[model samples]
Target: MLLAHDDEGSGPAVVLLHAGVADRRMWDAITPALAHTFRVIRPDLRGFGETPMPAEEYADADDVDALLASLGVTDAAVVGSSFGGRVAMELAMLHPARVSSLVLLCAAYRGLEPTESVRTFGAEEDRLLEAGDVGGAVDLNVRTFLGPEAGVAARELLTQMQRRAFDVQIAADQAVPGPAPRRVEVDPTAIAVPTLTVSGAHDLDHFRSVARHLAEQIPGAEHVELEWAGHLPAMERPDAVLALLLDVLRDDPTVHAP
Candidate 1:
């Protein structure tokens, strides 16, 4: 499947991966600027945004690689946030030649158990699901996942995008969507591409820990923390994120200030 993607501009390709909380629309704030310098491609992951769910078990890493192939892109820089980051890492791990570099933003790896707080939040979401209030679950996510500094507009954006995700996901799962399919665990040491990891200081400890761990594990991966941002720093500060991408694209050797 084409996966309902937006591909624009020209030059080296740069794929924008969205967080679980929001779909490809989350990159709307940054895409225009990126498109000016690179071919920006953003896709709605399966059962999110404009993409339909797979009939059988599917691998997100495969979906991404297929998308790029359909576009005749052999290799490109992949930028992913949160859930999208996991896909990015796996792609680099499983198909190292396909990814020129990776920009992991608050990304978590598979097989790692959820943090206590995340589990608590999941339980709360389950309760909302039991109550048949998907909107309530969305509200819970926006409050927890976004930075406390998020304003009314940011909250509104999250609410709309998250609700859309719920609708798509629920519609796809007639029966229980089975437990996660087994994955090939990622070894950060194996990823040799020039990599950068971005974390928001205001994000949950679990995510910050993932960021720190990835930075430590990946050889020479530079780490940057957005002091006032949260889990979705691109949404919180698109200008700074754009600048970071530009620096990487230009192969600037200067690491971001800690």
Candidate 2:
């Protein structure tokens, strides 16, 4: 399937892959600015946004390639947050010819051991679900993902998105062909595309490790930790994140013509 997406603007393409906690709407805050100079495509990953959870086994990277191909885009810069970031890396490794650049935000990778706080939060969230406390689970996400200093609006936005996710995936049932097999672990060194890894200064240690590892493993990949942000820096500080994105895009050799 092509997947539900918002495609706009015109120029060298730039796809916005959203965080796991939120969907395509998560890019609403900054899409307008991005649209001025780039063809921005934001898609709701399978089972996440307006897209229905499928009953068959599927590769997300395949879905992404399908979406881009359907749009006639041969290559583009990809920016992703959290799980979306993981997807971005997979795209670069699997379809190097189609990825011009990568901008990853707090992306997790295979064999990534969660930090103590993340582990605690995950167990607590699972317990909440088992206890049928959806609201409580949403609250837990706000506290766990958003930093302590995050303002009320950020908290509320996260609460709304998290609750929406529960309303969709939790309320629905999905069946895979069999056991949901994990994709082969991507070889980071195989990603020759220019990459930028961004994390929040206040983000979880697990994601911090992700940013560091990506930078160290992917030759010439840039890494930065934005101040006053947590896991979802795009939402918490959209302007700052947008500026960084513009900087990377403008300087990318792939983005400019020879």
What tens digits encode model 2's per-residue C-alpha lDDT throughout 1-258?
Answer: 679999999999999998888889878888999999999999988777788765666777878888999999999999999989988888887677779999998887875678898888889999998898999998888877776555787778778888888877775543333323249567888889889888777988888988988899998887877767789888887787787788788885432110
Mind giving the per-residue lDDT tens digits that candidate 1 earns over 92-169? Answer: 977788899999999977545679987898899999978999989998999888885666777889899999988877
- Indicate the residue-level lDDT of 164 in model 1: 91
Off by over 4 Å in 2: 148-150, 172-182, 252-258
Alpha-carbon RMSD, each predicted model: 1.9, 3.5
lDDT of each: 0.85, 0.83
TM-score of each: 0.93, 0.91
Q: In lDDT terms, which candidate is top? A: 1
Please give me the total number of clashing residue pairs in predicted model 2.
0
Candidate 1 yields a Cα-based lDDT of: 0.85
Model 1: residue 35 alpha-carbon error in angstroms? 0.8
